[model samples]
Target: MSDALNVEGIIEFFEKNARHPLTPEEIARHLGVGRRDKKRLLAHLDELVERGILVQLKGRRYALPRKVNLVTGTISMHRDGYGFVSTGEPEGKDIFIPARFAREAMHGDQVLVRAERGIRSDKPEGRIVRVVQRAHQTLVGRFEQTRKFAYLVPSDPRLGQDIVIPRNARGKARSGQIVVARIDSFPSKNRNPEGTIIEVLGDPGDPEVEVLTIIHQHGLPHRFPGEVLAAAEEIPGEVLPEEFSGREDLRDLLTVTIDGETAKDFDDAVAVRDEGQGRIRLWVSIADVGHYVTEGGIIDREAYVRGTSVYFPGRCIPMLPEHLSNGICSLNPDVERLVMTAEMLFDAEGVRLESRFYPAVIRSRARLTYTQVRAMIELGDTEEISRQGEVYPALQVMKTLAERLQERRRLRGSLDFDLPEAEIVLDLQGNIEDIVRGERYFAHRLVEEFMLAANEAVAGFLSAREIPLLYRVHEPPSAEKLQQFQEFLSHFNLKLSLRQGQVAPRDLQQLLDQVAGRPEERMINQVMLRGMKQACYSPENVGHFGLAAHDYCHFTSPIRRYPDLVVHRILRGALGKKGLSEHEKQRLAQTLPEIGEQTSARERRAMEAERDIVALKKCQFMVQHQGESFAGIISGVQAFGLFVELKEFFLEGLLRVSSLGDDFYHFEEERHRLVGEHGRRVFQIGDEIQVRVEHVDVERRQIDFVLEGAPPAAAQGDVADDGDS
Candidate 1:
């Protein structure tokens, strides 16, 4: 028996043979126990049966029973209720949990499962016997009140099960109203789980209703928990002198914070100055959130579990309270704040010679938005750079330095992906007003280059120091995808060559440069981008293929992301009095990879939520302009239909191939298009055509259109807006 176990002497007899079949004679020989003791232990083994751990047979064979292998993992459920358990197994394939096997384990649940190796299908499958932890018990959906009971049909299909409410718990839910429900339980004998109507959102098909659905679907807190808010309110909203005890004093240095107009969490700032003999020193300071959120503290643990702040277009689910995230931790102009600074000295060639990171106290002299910076770029008059001239001249110098760094990076084969990101303008009541894109200018580029350089420098230092930290790694796509891309691109007379270990970022960069100023440039660039893998954080350093950076980590936004917090903590531990223990280091090493995966998944979900909202808004916008013809380019072509992007407001819609009037279109897989058999009409990606809005589907967030004539006199009756570039 294990020394840790109680009643060891008699248990020793059972443990000797792993509680296998044993006659009294054999048991007596193993434990040197009397017949009486053997009988007593046998009676105890019978008691263990109550826990389902051990079983006894007619042959007196007492062995460990076939209890399911108790594994804990997050559930990834599908629309149809079936899901898979994403076990953080380094080698074994993920276990599939069939619809019935889920056993009420909702999506993202940390479930305890008893899995056996059994399969009638190709994939491995497992059954969930118990749920260790529920990711969320509350869900968002529309309530349906029948004569007898009510039901909450969830907006997120991932929930997979409708919550049924009996007459008493139904509340005032009408026949068809949007509502949030709190799950009570899934009865052993019932098909649906029971829940209570906790909130009434609104009627279905409302603009804000879609966003609320997403917020509830993800289980994001609309605001801070009461205790958290109370704790935040208790803390002062200013940096205290005692808190800056050991931090380096850089408040005297000129620094400016740059962000979007709506951004309140000003967590980063930049400053640059000529050091001597054509060398410059650039400083990147990030808000020292770690100083406020201490280890093992309530807020700290919550932040760790969340991993990052989630940003919606019109809202944000912040990691820290606004009093901190947008107040004390915010590097507002003319106010002293604690920061974690990365200082680097660079030569005329933009090659960094020295760098170091440490805690510091800084005062940002100005708060500049992208709009103001863009205006400055337009004027070409760098006079009004910052609120104070002290920070303004430094910003000009920084912009010059950042440009040089960008040139250096581009020369080093870093691919530039300046994708068009759109923003939604909502009124006070959260109604979509307009969708506008950011003006691509030097202002945005300067900020990006500086942050990229700082992140790269920190990443390099961490790697050189052999620090175990998370690095964002982007892997090259599989050979199969590359070959398919090559074949697909051949249709456009574009040839892309790929050889083993010869996939240089510079090659793609050069291709993009060559395709510049062409109509098909954006389409080809998007396709090439899709052929690359997503970048994610991991303890192991796998160089980022897109950036061509040998080392890359996120050290710029500790306010938004958790890995940055870990980096700050590690850097502090490595260089400060608070040295990390070996046990803590080991724990980080074991946990980081899994946490990275989860955070990356959440990031994707947030992006999708935003996209889904935007798509819905576009559909709403289209509903108002139905039956009007607008010029559009084919975004996607399928056998069933074609997705078209409207030229007017940049909205997208799908044109059903069946509605193309008496023509049978066959899908040409090789060409990524559909071809009409009789009319010789063809619909392929990037084909510009005028289409009248056919229908708008609010629930599905889809727009249907019917194809009309060709491009509006070379795609819109005018010299296609030169500013489009």
Candidate 2:
């Protein structure tokens, strides 16, 4: 009777009595609903039924959906026409939908599915009953014109169907031109989707057009709205004297910002001092973005929608307007800026002794690059040190403190995967000049340690006081995934010990240490990463598994990440003597869950868009090197073929199994290899070989490779499985 009017209360009632379907009258009686609240109870039940959370049986009886072999989730489509529906639960298995049973549901669509099992099948399959919501109302594709009619070919392969365009719907879109089409009608069992061309971009192969294609494909907001821009213009460009009231004045602190050479927005600056007896005092100052972008304002709403900034090869789509992100909120050198500072003291063991947060103002002494810091501190460059002047001593102290922190983290079994990243060099026309491996410097790690410490300190400070805020949580991997990973390791004659069918971070770290310099090191690292769960934002604290931190949150880059801004706002509210009022706490309790989910989805979207553009660029760069041979390693293996990564450049290509002309190869699923039945030749992951670039498809962002001496085989046979890379 406590929450009788709430939807959760109704769901809880059904869950407890799952085996018995109850009518509305019986449900009301069981929940002890009063006559005055009877209508409210009925409304909650109706809403639940509408959302597929509950199903109605004969005689007007209602029950939980899962109790009747039904599941609700989003469907992910395969390029080959099949699809899978994720149950949206942490430990739920995906329901496989074969091509014929896929119906008209498209990728990312929320749908209600009826679960079933096929003969001799070990896994469950599903048939979509109804689609609750469509993921895409408009999509980016290429328009094709025939003699009689026109259609649009979707840029994303998972779309799996072309869109028919009526004669009158083609608005100035020519043949072979990229366009954005709004779907007027969705697909049926026998017909394709119908659409109208709303916007026509330029032809394909153009640099700007390609970039726009990726942006539109991901539904990213590239340009600021007019209202948001106008709101940003109202804010002052410099810190005013009156704006510094009730703020600590740290303008004379020996602070400096370390970032890459091309960085424009400096969000965090650090200063370190060595106290006696191996004690250190650190100050991490972040730009006070909340000061300008108030809650529910136009600019704040736009930032919330964008969630985070998207960075491409040579461009960036910022969350906020340049007037704010690049002007007032940025910690430019020798300029007074408003900031929220995290001050902490650590003892000899790198354990934090005390910490506090406060609003402050600071004037950065210098804006140094990572390369310069590395030269001054690690390389001991005389000229670089002389050029740094007074900042050199601070850099030295920062280096020492960072080493201590790194050692402490390592002892706690933090997993660090030192994977290579590609740095694409673009010329004036945005054409690739060269592709090289990005260098990792000690200076980068030093700044990283300081930021991590600050983030942890802030999270601990707020969580200890019972504040409700978004947390950055990374949950542990599932037992099934770990078992598969263990099976894969058995091939290399390695074993991962598990206790009670569970794996700890230390177990994975030790495995990595065992394979430190072996040939299979990179492959094992990648596989381990894939097996782990992705990190996301949540209002509930579950502790970060990867960083080995019991408490963690994003607090460094508020200008780019919305979660950080949310944290800053919450921290400010708690800094007051009264803390958050009861009403304020209730409001946040109702809103933070949705905020966390939305921000997490937006972060994933940005990451996918960035990766898509990079893959396209890599494909474009390989176009000039056709028929060239390069030394490579077998990075992945599947039933379809071998994925080879080149040593000369950070690029991967697929060598189809059919291309092996000398023998018929059989796939070994458990061992991750392909073996020739007649020749007895085998190819497995981590094997070194030479490969020739056979083809490059820029539009699909795909590359094909062939054995160096093998004759060109017929068109690749039907792909039996998905290939990696």
lDDT of 2 by residue, 25-67 (tens): 8988888888888888888887887777887778988887687
Give the per-residue lDDT digits (tens) of candidate 1, residues 1-725.
32222344445545555545655456556656565465665666555543334444456655443322455577888766678887665334578887777756777877655666657866767887656567777888878876666788877656767788888887777868888888888534347788888888888777567778877777655566777777777778887889878889998888888888888898889988897787899999998888887876877767766667877667877877788888888899988899999999999888998998889999887898877776565565555544345655666677678878999999999999756866677888877787666467787888888888888988887678676788878877666667767777787777778897346788888888888866567777888888887788788888898888999988889888877887777777766665667887788788878778877776666667667667667777667887789888887766667778777676677776656665677889667788989898888877889898877766556677887752222221122111111
Q: Give lDDT per model, in order.
A: 0.74, 0.90
lDDT of 1 at 391: 52
Model 1 shows how many backbone clashes?
Answer: 0
TM-score of each: 0.80, 0.95
Worst 10 residues of 1 by lDDT: 716-725
Off by over 4 Å in 1: 1-136, 157-162, 184-194, 205-209, 381-392, 517-520, 577-584, 708-725
Q: What is the C-alpha RMSD of each candidate to the true structure, in Å?
A: 7.9, 2.2
Q: Best candidate per TM-score, number? A: 2
Displacement of residue 440 (Cα, Å) in model 2 is 1.8
